[model samples]
Target chain A: MPYVNIRITREGATAEQKATLIQGVTQLLADVLNKNPETTVVVIDEVDTDNWGIGGKSVTVRRKQGK
Target chain B: MPYVNIRITREGATAEQKATLIQGVTQLLADVLNKNPETTVVVIDEVDTDNWGIGGKSVTVRRKQGK
Candidate 1:
């Protein structure tokens, strides 16, 4: 069984987009590793911009700083 | 910064339990890898019984079979 975790900054991804992502990641694992899609698990986590940081600054602040 | 993804079977974990897990994982990463907890990302994925499988059998089916 292959478990895939995807993280993205919360930007209001539609349910359809999430579904597509789940499907595509499952397919990619199956094609590359010959894993069974039925046994593959894909979970998506959407983090708030304030909670997600890079280079010691939150994404929200970084974006505001035009970085 | 360390990004940690935790996967567990969906068994109705309480909000407190999840919060504890997130805190513990963040602490572990900080202690062991010297990562910054403020920048550490810990996302927990609780998989459905039907979507999580082992030995080619879903957890739901396996549970039903008492396996």
Candidate 2:
């Protein structure tokens, strides 16, 4: 079984979008690696902007700084 | 910076429990990998029983079968 974890900065993704992502990722794994979707696990985690950082700066601050 | 994603079957983990996990994982990465906690990201995803499977059987079914 292959487990897929997707992390995204919380920007209010609708349920439909999340469903699409889960389905697409599952299909990709099945197609590329011959994994069974029935046994695959996909989870999506939405992190708050303040809790997610890049280049030593939180996404919130980076967005404000426009860099 | 290190990103850690933890997946577990949805068994009603308390907020405090999740907080402990986040802190522990972050500290582990910082101590072992020399990662910065401020830039470290930890996300926990609780999967439903029906969506998580092992050996071609969903957790729900396996639980019901007592195997």
lDDT of 1 by residue, B1-67 (tens): 6876668888787655666666677777778888887778766667899999999999999999988
Q: i-RMS, every candidate?
A: 6.0, 5.4
Which candidate ranks first by lDDT, i.e. highest?
2
Candidate 2 Cα outliers beyond 4 Å, as residue runs:
B1-6, B9-67
The local distance difference test score of each candidate is 0.78, 0.79
Top model number, TM-score:
2
What's the residue-level lDDT of B66 in candidate 2?
Answer: 92
Question: What are the per-residue Cα lDDT tens digits for candidate 2 across A1-67?
Answer: 7987678898887656666676788788888999987778776667899999999999999999987
TM-scores for every predicted model: 0.55, 0.55
Instruction: Identify the candidate with maximal DockQ.
Output: 2
Per-prediction DockQ comes to 0.08, 0.14
